[model samples]
Structures are given as structure tokens and as C-alpha cells.
Target: MHSLSKLFLTFVGFVGLSLASPGGGEDLPAVCDFAALRARWPKESCEALTSIQAGLPDLLRRVRPYTQTYVLVLLDRPDGVPRAWDDPVLSRLRVGLLADTPAETIAARYKFAQVVPYPLSPAGACALFADLHRGKIDAGLVWAPLAGYFVAVTDVENRLQALPVPQPLPPLEWPKSAWEGASASDSDLFRCADRIQGVLESYGVAPAELLTANVEESSVIPDQPPPEDLAAARVGEALYYRYCDRCHGTQAVLGRRGLELRQRFLQLSYPEFIRAIWEGRPGRGMPAYRGLLDKTQIEALYQYLRALTLGKIAPRQSTD
Candidate 1:
């Protein structure tokens, strides 16, 4: 009877194990299946998912997804950037954070001499690094992809570094919903928000909140110029602000390394201007705008630059 009881206990344990297994008719939906998640969560939680998925390839491609945390640091010497986490002098330096960064969250993670708030957008990571390079700020926290792009373009990898923020590994938490049995979390949605936040933070010249501002759309250029030229220049100015102005500056004068177009306007003819922008100076960190900006937009940018260079239009002050 004792042996019979032992055998029955073993059988029950085996049945329990089988029922808990994935093949036991209790498998969870794949994490990538948004449709399954949508059915599980409310509609609004999934709204950000589409944009998140759309941008993931570009954002994730730039950094190791396995890296949990990062810190931006300035190299003491050109060769002083530390390769390992335990390297010395890391805690002694002053650090820069995005103006909108939840300082409380970061302060709890690491000790620094001080945390300086930089007014740039997160897309302005390069600009932030430029600040570091110029000694405007000591060190800054930046995303891996932005750091990678900065190093690639400026060839300044040795001059700066991003150290992994040393912390007890925290379990990756995803955005949770109130629905019953909705085990999946909205990690993608948070990542999407992070991407947008990064862009806003790096754009230091303007208020990060202005990204969502509901300003009435009007012609970028006044209605005084020839209608054709006015239309083209206006579109180009918008393109320039969106793509070019961060590094170039409001008047194209404050560019980190970009030529002050106002000063060099006479030296570059329209064709030369177009060629420079279209082809880009690759080794100098200028990306070719050919595929990104179409011929018409490029022309409009050229016209806008020309207008700015020739003193035909006053540079618009950043209201932020």
C-alpha cells in the first residue's frame, strides 16, 4: 500500500508538469503579435504601438538591445575614456541631463559632482556631444544610437564615451494594463515615447513641449517674393528647420562645424550650394540629403539659404 501511494503521487506530479508546459494548451501569444495584444488591451495603449514598431528598426539597429543602461561622459584625456564599468573618475565628473529628464529617477541611479540641464533636443545628441567636445558641458546621458551616430560622423569616439550605468539589474518592466489575463506589457509604446523624447531633448534651442504645440500653419516666407520662389523657399525653410537647423543654428551661424552660410553665401553659387547639400561632405559628418530631401525641397532649401545669406529675410528668432 505504501508503494502504491508513492506511484500515485509521481503520476500526479507528472500530470501537473505537463499541464504547465507550453505545449499543454496554455501557450501565451507571441510578443510581436500586436493584433493579439490589442484584443487583450484597450485601443489607446496600442495606438502608440504602430509608430513604435515602425521606428524600432531604425532605433534598435544603432545600439545593443541587451545593454540595460547608459551614461554619457567626457574623456579626461583623448585616451582617458574608460572601457569597463569599474573605471575610476567616473563619479567625480559633472554630468549633463536633458532639461525634461526626470532628474529624480537618474539621481537615484548614480552619483555625480553635479547634473547640468542642457536645453537641446534628444535628436540633438550630436549637438550635445558637440557641447562636450567644446567643453560647454562636461558629460551627458545619451542613447546608444545617437552616440554611435555622433562617433561615426565626427570621428570623435576617443574624445568621449558612454559608460553603462552600474546598477543592480532590474527586471525589464513593460507597460501593464488592467485587463484580466493580459500578461503582455506595452514595452514598445514606452520605447516609442523615448524616441520622441530623445528628439525633443536634443533640440535644445526650442522648448521640447513645442513638438505638440498647435500653431496655425502659415507660409514660412512672407507673401512678398515672387509666388514661385516664395512657395519653394517657404517649404525649404521648413525642411531646413526640421533637418538642418539643429546643428546649423537658428541663423545658420551657430553651426557646430557647419559653415556659417551667411558669411560664405557669396563664395557658393546656387549650383555649388545644391551640390554641397545634395552630395554632403561625408568625412566631415554631413549626411547626403539626396534620398531624404527631394530635388524640389532641396531647391527650396537652397532658396531659403540664399535669402538668409543675402539678408533678404530676417532670421526668425526661436520663440522657445
Candidate 2:
């Protein structure tokens, strides 16, 4: 009986050792080189191993490595409808857009064949959230904060999923000759064009169609305040100090975590500026102040920002 017990213990020890070993007791390469692994295993198996190695910490190196890339994601609906970009029934998908995001920009990026625009305003975002709760639309392109807002307001967890746009490989860098034409070879130009075309293809876009597509240029109307409205500017200055100073800093120099409002106001059209202020970029830490501040107050804020940009109002130095 003692000999049998000793044999059982020996068997358990062997099993444990086998389980801990790479490939379950099979002798495998010590180095986690994907190129080497691919020669021995199936492509998929090799890729899985590569991904696993990429995720695990390199104890010897004592540093983490990660790739930075952005992908166009398809938002999934909570309703019983299929959650895929290529669903035949979902060929005509309505996209929700913030005022800042031009419809042309979305078309250029995603290359959606059939897009019905549903622009989301400050109030409209909440209404859209309600519509999403009832599963009205197939999907909505929303930022992280807006998605969070929807879930918070509607109390739905499985409402949306952001799936990354798949790419077989990283996009090729555009050649310098592609931009500067003074010293460009025909072959170099063709190669750069081909690379760009490949990138568009990865996004499911037809390169030929884009070649002939005409995108309308948005008109910009400069914000010009009358000399008498200096009083309004003063009022705007007070409002800016109270609400915007913390983020925008003095004279909109972009204080801690603050975007350069003066620069943005100068570049963007009047309507765009108003929309940005009213709607705010929820995903980018800017809160919607539609109800918090009235139209007149918002206009005042805009005036002050514009004045600063136009050199009418001098920038105040930070006290800190």
C-alpha cells in the first residue's frame, strides 16, 4: 500500500510538470519569434501565439510595447438585429453626427455606400439615446462620453459595441514625392497612389468612386462685432473668467487640459463655433452647455473669444 501511494504521488508530479511546460511537454523553441513559429505551425496558430506573446509582459526587458492605431468601428445595437457591418438588411444605415463632424468627413473616412444622416444636437443627443433604447436605428457613430451618457440616461448595458476596423497590415507611409511634385518620378507617384488606394480599399471604399466624387466646401463667415458691442464683450469677459478661465486659461492660451479656444474660434466658421459651444465635444472632456448657458450668454462668450483672437483684447498672463 505504501509503494502504491508513492507511485500515485510520482504520477501527479509528472502530470503537473507536463502541464507547466511549453506545448504541454513538447520541446518548442525558447524564443517567441513569430517568423520561426510560423514555419512549424499553421498560420492562425502562429498568429495566436504571436498575439499572446505581445500581450504578456517581457520580464527580461522590463518595458511594455504597444502599437498606436485608429480604426473605424461599427456600433452594435442591443436589439435582436444582426451586429455586423456587412448585413444585407442593414445596407442603408443611418449615422448620427455631431455638429463638429461634417458629413463629407464621414463619407471620406468610412466610405459607407448608403448613409442617411441624423445630426445630433444638444437636445437631439438625448432624444437619439431614447430612440436607441427602443432600437429605432441600426447603429449610431458616437463618441465614448456620448455612449456613456446614453447608457447612463437609458440604463442599458448591451446597447452598443465598438468593433475596430480590421486591417491585414499597417498602412504604407506616403512618399515625399506624393506631396512635392517638383522632383517626382512617374513610378514613385504611381507607387504612392497605389499605397493610398490600398488604404482606402481596407476601409471598404472604392478608390475609383472617390476620384470622381465632389465634396462641397463649407463656407466660412467671419464673426465681426460692432464697436458698440464692447459692453457685450465686457459681459463675455466676465462669463469667460467665471466658467471658461479654468480650462481656457487667461486669453485662451489653453490652461491645464484646455484646448486653444482662441485658435479654434479663429479657424472655424461662426456657425461651427456656435455649434461647438452649444453641443460641446462630450467625448473630448468638453461638456454640453446648451441648457446651462442661454443663447445670449453663449454669444457673449464667442465675442470675447473672437476679440482675443482678433487682438482686440490682450491676453492675461497665468498667475500660477
Leading candidate by lDDT: 1
* Cα misplacement distance, residue 269 of candidate 1 (Å): 2.4
Give the range of the ten consecutive residues with the poorest summed lDDT in model 2. 57-66
The TM-score leader among the candidates is: 1
Q: For model 2, name the residue pairs that clash.
A: none
- The alpha-carbon root-mean-square deviation between model 1 and the true structure, to one decimal in Å, is 19.6
lDDT of 1: 0.45
lDDT of 2 at 159: 29
C-alpha displacement of 287 in model 2, angstroms?
0.6
lDDT of 1 by residue, 100-130 (tens): 4443366556676676654333222333554
Every model's TM-score: 0.36, 0.31
